[model samples]
Target: MTTKKYADFIYKQTKGVCNIMVEQMFSDYVLYKDGKRIGALYDNKLLLVSTENLNKLFPNAVQEKSFDWGYYKLIHIENTEDKELLEKAVRITYDDLYFQKDFVTDISYLFKVNKRYQDSITKIYNLHITFLRFCYDKGLLKINPLDKQDRILHMNFLNNDLTENGTKIFNELYDKWLVYTDKNDDKTDDRIVNTKMLEKYYLSIIDKLQINS
Candidate 1:
């Protein structure tokens, strides 16, 4: 675990050289530069992110494995009073990992499209409800939110517009919501609950993907 003091020290040290953001992950703090992860602060030590490029650059850097699938070299920045050295190390790592454009922009754009599609589908579904209400008011057609048109519109939106991963996530949440619906008999109300759950999931995935970029 990274203490707040240690994490702040590393973050403050790199201030003039580049922008760094610290993220808390299961009690440990990981640092990112330009939307790309640069290092992690674990056990009060700052270690540059391990990669083939980093390995080549610092061959003698010790290999410290933090988990089953990953390890990184000690950047020798821990508790050091040498600001110049700290600044230089941060600059090199940031420059090496930084890209011309951050991938977050693309993810944001993708979600914007997804949001537009979701909004359009919702409007259409509401329009159908309004039409059905108008018809019923005029004694033309009796309808509810679960009418045939509603089902068809929902299925088309799910199958055609949603990506495979998105579909999988939605299906999983939908299955759970199905259980809730079975017990409570209120599917429409649970839709809001499921939507909130999906929003959190999507945000987490986007953050992970952006950091990995």
Candidate 2:
């Protein structure tokens, strides 16, 4: 069984790499970075998610099944005193899992909005808004794009932190919403069509940004 003291120790050791968080799961502790599970402390042992790069880096490290029925395995780091190696392993594992598996692709797949109305433009807009709000709620976005007060803050974050492609994607999405608001006159039943178009556009932007990142 894992104790809180040991879990806190492990978290303190690896937190310098990123925003590592520890959550109790029964008697063990699972670790997360930016809302993505990266590792865990099982049986008072530090176990990180097994990744190709991490396995290559630590060829002789012990491997164990993550759970009784799960196909995924975890790497056991025996040298708990070596904080440097632990941090490096956590960082590499996090990068591999987050960028390769759980980034924008998962977001798009998990939060896809269903088109229920054929002609209700407001409904389409609201559904898209819900998707963005979901992203914020899930800790994917630092600023809520739907909030008018967060407009400047969000733009500043894009300009300062994200890559050129990321910034462009966000700007294009924001511009699309702005255009929709500016031209509120609906002459035809194009809400469904526009909703599909916007969803595709949003996904493409995420994909491009992920590739560039």
Candidate 3:
């Protein structure tokens, strides 16, 4: 299990130097740069991945073998407090492992993935509104467009259709929409027909109608 303190340490050490995000891989926290796996935190220690460029960058860097795998050699970072040294090691490893083509491809792939995810959420919301409209027509719902309270219930029903993060965002949007609607309910002149004219027309339409005698 990766500890927050250990993960935070690496994130802090590399702050403003390089783009990095600490992620857990197989119970070990690994650092990624431009979608490349560059380093890892194992047993509460930071280790830069062993690669040709890493070996070249730090010729005297100590290589330790993990007990999990006999042949796997990892460069353990002993001086955890040496920010400058740590940054240099990480920077060199990142540079060496960096590939322009792979970087561009990964970025494009990420964009496509995000776009598809957003589209799916939009589709879900469209269906959700359609379902709510049906319910409103059947006199089962009070709000046609749905209020936060109703939306929360609808979201729960379709929870499996969304990612955990997506659900949180959707809920937040629901709250915002509720607040906005509450604020603008009386201010906005959004009604199509005047209530007085509508009521009068409905009430007197039969009296004003001519019969074909």
Candidate 4:
């Protein structure tokens, strides 16, 4: 959707042609063949992961951008696009864990040219994931030559000492995000989950919260 070329390692590695980036369903991305989604995008490039993975790598990845929810988990990926800063950013983004809806309490980073937002709960989380998806889509966080070790940083932070108030604040903010998302999106039982986009925001908020916490 963006004109700017993202920092994608897959594009660099395969010269812009990778069919099944993930092991499971190729739904995260619509692979372009002559500009059409023949399948999904999952390579060493980026893929979906679990909530536990989110927390383990979030601190090191998106240290500059984080949020709250206390779930502390994320997916793992081996960035090999040659952009350390961007890979660091993506590592910080919980790119594959947004489908659960058990965590994630904010979405206000979509239009975040500035740190603080006016909408607080609803806008923060929504915008945050939106921005991550945009970055991923536009290859803003793609890195090259991702080391084998770089893909596995699943160290849990739950045992670490997070402030009681910080935890409370995280929950409060996250709750606001939930309400906002429900209000804006359909509240039907059959609602669909956009995990790709969720991954972006999940990591973004986790990164933000770590700093503010």
Top-lDDT structure, candidate number: 2
- Residue pairs clashing in model 1 are none
Prediction 2 global C-alpha lDDT: 0.64
List model 2 lDDT by residue over 59-174, tens digit each. 99988665541566888888878889888888889877765343232222212343443344454445456445543543445456667532222212323333334434655664
For model 4, the local distance difference test gives: 0.34
Q: Please, what are the lDDT tens digits per residue for candidate 3 over residues 49-151? A: 7768678766777776662433446787777788887777787777655632221111123234548577444433443454444334433333344665545
Against the reference, the lDDT scores of all candidates come to 0.50, 0.64, 0.54, 0.34
Misplaced by over 4 Å in model 2 are: 65-69, 101-213
Against the true structure, candidate 4 reaches a TM-score of 0.17
For model 4, residues 1-213, the per-residue Cα lDDT tens digits are 211132243344444232322122332333233332222233323322333444464434322112221443223344444445323333323223222212332222333543554443434434434433333343333322123442212211221212333333334443443443453444422221344434444456657666431
**Backbone clashes under 3 angstroms, per model:** 0, 0, 0, 53
Ordered from best to worst lDDT, the candidate numbers read 2, 3, 1, 4
* Candidate 3: pairs in clash: none
In candidate 1, what are the lDDT values of residues 11-100, reduced to their tens digit? 787766656688888878877875667777778877775545555555667655653224434453343467776666665676555531
Q: In angstroms, how far off is 161's CA in candidate 2?
A: 17
Off by over 4 Å in 3: 67-73, 100-213
The C-alpha TM-scores of every prediction are: 0.39, 0.49, 0.42, 0.17
